[model samples]
Target chain A: MNGPSIQKPEIEFTDNIRDRNRYGRLWVYIFRFSTIIGIIALATLLFNIINQSSGYVVYEAKGDPAALTLDGVPIEEQTKDQLMRVLSSHLSKGAYSKLDRTKPFAERSRNDVYDLVVERIVKYEVVDSWLLWDSLTRKDEITAAVEEEYPEALLRFDVWINSDFLRRPQSSNPVIAGVRTAVLGSLWTIGITILFAFPLGVMAAIYLTEYAGDSWANRIIQTNINNLAGVPSIIYGILGLAIFVRALEPLTSGTLFGVTDPTSANGRTILSAGLTLGLLVLPLIIINAQEAIRAVPNSLRHAGYGLGATKWQTVWSHVLPNAIPGILTGTILAISRAIGETAPLVVIGASTVIYFDPEGPFSKFTTLPIQIYQWTSRPQDEFRFLAAAAILVLLALLLTLNAVAVLLRNRYSRRY
Target chain B: MEQIALGYPKSRNGLKRRFRVGENAILALLFISGVFSIFTTIGIVYELGKEALLFFRTPNVDLWSFLSGTQWQPHIDKFGILPLFTSTLITSLFAMLIAAPLGMGAAIYLSEYASEKVRGFLKPILEILAGIPTIVYGYFALTFMTPLLRTIFGRDVVEIYNTASAGLVMGILILPMIASMAEDALSAVPNALREAAYGLGGTKLEVALKVVVPAAISGIAAAFIVGISRAIGETMIVAVAAGAGPNFTFNPFKGAETMTGHIVRISGGDLSYDSIDYNSIFAIGLMLFFVTLTLNLISQQVVRRFREVYE
Candidate 1:
């Protein structure tokens, strides 16, 4: 008591949350740091997109401007970025083509030339960007006056929502950028992966649940299967490269050490991609499917037996129906993992791109993520915006699939 | 000798009095496919192992040097596994450092703190990060993430291909697994324990940390182990963001390769399977296989041994 003992505050209803922020400071710091990072990454992507999207300006002379014929009608025009590139290229090519050939480069007002280009776009001589942000915000005064003045000069504006972006192939000019081949490729490959993996996984599961004895033989088999599930997926790609593309093709073609079928997609096709992915997801499906089948009540099986139904009949008609929800859940999760897998595809060397939509299982193709990877890796900032848009599309697709799976799970669960 | 699966009560077959011999046949067939899958696994392993054996027999692949040496340039005649393994371990550890806490915190909030309505909204959003493809994550790491990390820290804190960026992005990639599975483990704890803790004047935090988590320790360990297993096997993100060099240092600012990275590198090349380079891929693959296999086995055993709690 002589040491000036501090008296602890008495417990009170109001004191329940004393220094509420103090106790969990570590956790709160971590939570805040994580949340801030997540938000910051998202914000950075968005801001970079908006910045790159604010491209440079361009201008063109009225009579001598570059012209393109649309539906046999000649139109002279320029978008800001396009105008800048064209002007820069022309100026670089020759002295006379420069905006102020006689004036000092520093003294020349290229801004006037830029305005003239914008004026020409406004004058209906050409179309402005169809980019949705600029279009929706419609700088009407900037574009409308030119259209009204150039009654004879047809104006074309770039609209971001045109069907062509999704309906066309990628072009050298990004103004006509599209993901048609890549989208179709992913769809077809995914279709194949699901088709191949699902039946095999389910069947393997059925065998495991209904069969496998307790002897060492069965145990070893089970242990090996579990280990197989843990193998790194890139190894599967190596297997595919050796087995599917190289060795088997030659043997399967009925040729002696010669896989000389010129027409054969150079041995890499959607079929190869699908099979590789199937192998990767196969172990997951089998394990989960087995668990799902095992979860079904034994009482139901006994009832089926009591009714004098055969074993196969009992399983097909009764056990399967009851186990539907678990099987579905397993399949959906497996599919979700498969959809996001990129490593094996890379190891197998998935075609970087294809100009045409896939015509068969043998046709070469790329996926959205691959395209996004290629685009984001580029030095140009415009491609980054395109990559972001593609990511948004991919995110929407994945979310919708997962939602459907969840919805089905809920709907089936209620019946049980 | 006529085939009759069953018989009426009036005229029972000799086999009906005991058990039908045919029952064994059906069970046998079911077990055969399990046997078949095992055979497939063995066949693949055998193929890889045989090639690797051949590689070791040659003077070119020095197993001792590969395992202990600092260099890992297989392309230009240097063979070292140490630096690659070190990078693999370092990146995986960094990823675990970030993901384990964030993921577990999210798990705790969902299980013990959030109302059902809040959980409903939060869980799906958490998975949003997971559903983004590994390739997309790789791009995000290279383009968006590296620059951000550079800005926050000084430029010296970053490399063209840094492990920190890839590891952090990979942490985000694997977060859903830890969160969802850990939540399952947390919820599996009996409500009675929580009630008893509250009865003893314990707060929600006390009940959760003391009773629920302790009870689910085995499952939580399984989650962490599985999460790390995934991080090790994950490929594209590391390949793109984490440079292919096998730097033996512990710096996350530097670039390094993992086993999966080496496999990708060889296969990505248009190399013939008969070559020494191609065989090296199999050798590395076998290593990856065993490493991940051990992790999975440990996880399975942990769950089996300590997970049970009677309701």
Candidate 2:
């Protein structure tokens, strides 16, 4: 009796799981399918863009000119000031000149039309053909561009490899068919959008994340922000039109434009376009930034408090720096989305007809998506090709920006 | 509890008191921002709300009519949003169907079958694919996927703008959502459970399906809902790949316009402020926002309930 002990019962249920296939085979199939799908998707995207972009016929030489020679000949014989005037297009009198030929593509690409009086166009060994597209389509406009710059060599105009329709700006002449103005417009617009939105977005995020105690108010704000992020962006367009365009026209400009006359943009300048876009992106920026800020530990905040620091000091000294990487990632994403935005800008009266680069924040501008849409909608086949090329460039810029953001976030992630 | 003196000092130090006072002002500063955000939110709501109310005041503003009607011609007379709403939900649901299985499959492979090394490589790659801009994916779906889809099933299978292609690409985007979330939930299951299953002579697949998955059911469900929200809010890919005309149809093969797509199309057409036409955007925006918010809230609550967090 002393030796006897209570015994635990033996487990009796049998699994009897007679699986047919090796587990690895099933998993291998799944993983392989996933990778294949992803790769194909990415490859198809890049390949289509490259194929379309490469098919574009680069003109021997082309661009906007300030004056027309009326005789269609090369401008190599023209003087420096005349070429400068031609390059400036009567907008401003900036000096320009002949860049050295036989340089690398990067250097050659840098040479403006003003610098290319004798300078070579991009990546072509053609010594004599002036950089220009044929006036086959544009009898009048072609004559004007040829008369302006190629007064000497206009007769020898053949499509060269230096200036594909992708590299130039919109003009009455197909010779000026490129995305330069659009690309710059996108840059400036997105730049302004970032500058306006970043501070406010980060501040709001900081307030929400590092400061707000868990409460009904905080929860409500968080919910509202997330919902705002989901709100169709066109609504923001309506908002921008009402609040920024019509209602605040006086603040934008007294006469709509600084000029004595009023235009469609009237007071609707690059600033207004950027501000509208800024508002559109602000909710996303705040949400992502809040997530980043929240990732920083409460222990870090407590440590600072334990050290007799104030909440502001603790956040500044510890929280923000820790969250910087995430904040940057979110900012970059917001910017990427802003760069691709077209709808809101169109509604806010972005000038679809602009030919010149925006002169200032007050000046009107057009961006990549807008320009692409204009080209895509047109009946011209060449314009479609040009649109494809422009898309490639836009994609590259967006990708590079996002990649850098991700890289930075990843690199810094290790430290924390 | 024993560190009673750790509490903030009741009296200020003379030398540091000014700094201390400034420091104390931080709470107020933060509180002020909270107040400011509140006001800003109110301002937006007021602006949008006023426009929506104004729209309702106009003749023949019936909520039921808007919900059930098919046409979306705001300028002429009939402004039915049902077609667009239907398209949005259908595309999102279609994407969920394709993505859920593939995503769950990948998750199972990741959590149960793959070694740590494979996981590291695959996870980052998948994320990178997911990280690529939706704009790029939009282009891909249109150019690449459409052609392939057409090849498999005639030209009728793919339209220049159709739900089928977009749903496919959106499925790819949601892949990461399901994978990461499912992995998180599945990985949360205890090792002891797996060992117990093995001791009972269960196969790996059996153990995964019967024990691990059931344990993580709530999380997996939440992941799928979050994926739905992601799909609903998805804009660029739809704008690019899916056609602009908002058709009221359930067929995935046909060109259907989503709510976001309609917004894009309208915004592109240059409507001036508060045009009875323009107020339609605000109403739609409110609808989209509410749907997504509810989905997100459900997702969050589900995660909280499912999260084990055992020490």
Candidate 3:
């Protein structure tokens, strides 16, 4: 009963829709392909790092540890006194004296002396190395290559990350190098960052959301904070270099407290780095905390007022308790950012090769990122391996902190 | 609660006064905290300006030559910034080429095409990409990307330390930023438009492209701008993989220096605090700061405009 004109229009429309659907499917596949690239990139990054961190190495000691052994006692098995003598006797008198002056060998443990002997005396130099995948899949090929490359060098599988990697301090030699000093410095700086940024950020957010009037001044402050968050971190480094390092050197270097080293002090201390990082993260915390505070229902505030509670009292008792979890969430993110940050610390003159742990707020410091950067820039392939291991440690620390934050956020969300 | 309120008598006016004083003190403290951000900005400008001004004040230095010249040999004392500026642009362009399309497409997929379950599973994975430190990415660029690139482009074509490797890794680093921001914009678009397109027999892709993308264009543009800013400011990747030699060439296969790379290289070396070379980095930093700041402000304005339209 339908007219030919109506049927013809319907058929044409159907054809057009079909053609569009085919093209749509093609575009959908392309979009999916783009998203897959991100996942692939992550996988590639992990694979590349893990591959470098472990492998086969053909190492040749310049002066073999066995030659230093008295009565066949290997260097690693030597007692503290014996190891000390071995290290001292092997080293040139001036070098030994310099080592002693740097840190007394007498006070160091047997393990430390043994490490020193291995590093200074034994001097294990990697002649050749292979990545983990090659070591595993092309085992015969690697063995042949090593043999062809150096018959004298010992061939063995090695995991770059071990207990020694965590315990030992920075060394010029990659075999003895570790992240101990850097880890301590990172912890100290992050500790200061949280102390400085957390309370101030939360307080500012509380004041703006709970107490402040809708005045132009308050509005300006709010906008300033938002802009600050977008500022490049290196600019903060410039500020830290200027204000904390130069202008406020007396305070940051602890000279104002009369406890700092007068000769070496230039305000390029952990205190300066931490305070700069604090500034870097302040806006982040304030923004996040503001969001948290704003999420609190107005009804709750009204209930407090109806109960004759003062504005401060209501915010303190009811609002703060409810908002604590959210504030913590923001703080966790800020701490993570500060911990991973390298540019500002570098700009503020954090020593890339610092061997000493941060002694106090005023002490010079280096962080995990700085350590990794320093190692990666070196021409040695072995330092790259060390950098990879340090990266794993850094990732573990960041992930644990972030996991806690996520858990808290989820728990609070579920409860409310 | 009622009994506690009643228990406060007129004789407890002293306690009330103490409480009021505490409140005022705390408010003042908060006000001080709020002003700290403003102080930081001022400190940055002042420090950068002071040294940058010192750089220009050097008797032999001509401002025009410094800005327009091509050579950046601090050893030779030639501080033309054109090479650095051009390298930065070339690297940033490569980064944009990789980031813009992939990030936008990923954002579209996450917001429009992906199911709820897929989006939930993928978002955190993308976030993990963001959480990775830049130093690590730098290493990946140096060791992995460089060799891989050399093999593909041939040994003669790709240098060991080239802009391509750094730019590629930087693109990966900023991909999460672009995707997340663009996804936010896409999600903000009302679903009613999508439903209307579907009712007219429009497919998912058609609806996403024709209906959602146009609606979210400003937001997507903001995401790309922010990505550019991030790429420009990134230090470790460029500093490590992009060679410190400031070259004016546009070839991605060759090594070149970026502004951040230049700053890091100079600062990391043994430069005296008062040296003209050290002060030169401050001038470079000033340029970087303004460029990034302007981009960020523009991005914010774009987002605001998008909000006005959609809301």
The candidate scoring highest on lDDT is 3
Relative to the unseen true structure, what is the C-alpha lDDT of residue A49 in candidate 1, on a scale of 0 to 100? 42
- What are the models' TM-scores? 0.77, 0.76, 0.94
Q: Per-residue lDDT for B294 in model 1? A: 85
- Give candidate 3's whole-model lDDT: 0.86
Give the worst 10-residue stretch by lDDT in candidate 2 chain B: B1-10
Q: Write the per-residue lDDT of candidate 1 for residues B146-258, one digit (tens) a residue.
A: 88778888788788788888898888777767878888999998888889988987666667778889998889999999889988888887887888756787888888887
Which residue pairs of candidate 1 clash? A59-A117, A60-A117, A122-A146, A122-A147, A123-A146, A127-A156, A130-A158, A130-A159, A130-A160
CAPRI docking class of candidate 1: acceptable
DockQ for each model: 0.33, 0.32, 0.46
In candidate 3, what are the lDDT values of residues A1-416, reduced to their tens digit? 56555434444433576777899899999899999899999999999999999999989989876799876787767789888788777889999999898889877888888888888878889888888998999999889988887987889898998888999888888888889999999999999998999988998898778766677777788888888888878878877877898889899999899875733647888899999999999999999999889888888888887898876788899889888888899889888988999888888888877776678998888899999999898888898999999998899899999999999998986244
Model 1 stretches with alpha carbons more than 4 Å out:
A1-72, A75-162, A170-177, A213-226, A251-266, B1-13, B17-33, B244-248
Candidate 1's TM-score: 0.77
lDDT measured at residue B128 in model 3 versus the true structure, 0 to 100: 93
Candidates arranged by DockQ, highest first: 3, 1, 2
| Candidate closer to the true structure by lDDT (higher is better), 2 or 3 | 3
